[model samples]
Target: MGKSPDIIKDTSETLKPVSGRGITVMQGWYDKNIKACHVTLWDLGETDDNFSDDDAEGVTLSVQVTIFSQEDEVELAREIKSLMKADGFSFEGRNGDDSEPEDGIYMKAQRFSKFYESEE
Candidate 1:
């Protein structure tokens, strides 16, 4: 099985504290009606066990986290970076400059990566 579900669950749990007041932490996509912290995952590659080349060992994945808010998002973005890092993700950096996609909503995206060892 893929580690997608585990990653998503960990992300949701890590960001749950910031999930009220019309804002939410979601996987894959977000609702435009409210503020959101959206997470998208991509499997980058896999590694083989060092001892035996035939056995799969782990996978590396890239996680894109985008935050959309009706207010300034710098503080929230920093908080998210800290939280995700504490949860074992290595911060890769911001994906792009912050932008206002609509009249009042602001958006910022960041990248992170993690390696998950295969389950026996």
Candidate 2:
């Protein structure tokens, strides 16, 4: 099974017509350099006992998504949510609180959970 960030990035690329600048792993204050709708990905954590056997392995990953935009991010967020669900990623929930904008860049944080398994 893939890690949170890797999985999210792969899924994001599958979405079409996304106006965002790009999808990439979240780095500290990196959004400040980008001037478009940019999505940042981070790993919150993984489930316990993710390994079942030598040939079977599973992981429930918590992926943190942050949307950086100068305008409202609602539509973009909704598209992302729909695409993620359509791709079989579970929607755990989002942060009740939001982060303050930095340099006219507004941000919204959402958390998504997904379970993956691989058999060797």
Candidate 3:
């Protein structure tokens, strides 16, 4: 087993990646009145060998994005944080897990615990 994959973001340290790749963020901009809010999400990227393009018996790692708010930044942040908890999100399988999609790769939503930030 690896790290428990429980992530809690406090500072930039908690969201940095171990390797020098890049932190993938699913985000959007929302404008309400005079305030323009930006929503960003950070999570783990999983690579499952079991997942293949065949779509028969494959399980890959991926992420899911759902808008939680369009009003206040506080509400938006709250919704984004709620999504970070994977509430409505269930990990039953992949998109085409029930049928074959000519590919053998699949992606599932998973959480990560640790990350590394550069001291620049």
Clashes of each: 0, 0, 14
Instruction: Give lDDT per model, in order.
Output: 0.65, 0.65, 0.31
Candidate 2 Cα errors over 4 Å, as ranges: 1-5, 19-30, 49-57, 97-103
Best by TM-score: 1
Off by over 4 Å in 1: 1-5, 20-22, 35-54, 99-102
Given candidate 1, what's the lDDT at residue 21? 43
TM of each candidate vs. truth: 0.71, 0.69, 0.23
Model 3 residue runs over 4 Å out of place are 1-35, 41-43, 49-56, 60-74, 81-120
Q: What is the Å distance of residue 53 in model 1 from its true position? A: 1.7
Model 1 compared with the native: what TM-score? 0.71
lDDT per residue (tens digit) for residues 1-120 in model 1: 453435566666777666644356767644665544443333333333434567656665666777766665888789889988998888988866556555666667777776777766
Which pairs of residues collide in model 1?
A: none
| lDDT, residue 4, candidate 1 | 41
- RMSD per candidate (Å) reads 3.8, 4.2, 16.1
Model 3, span 12-103: residue lDDT tens: 23223311234233333222331222223334354434324643232233343322222322343333344434432333221222123233
Report the backbone clash tally of model 2: 0
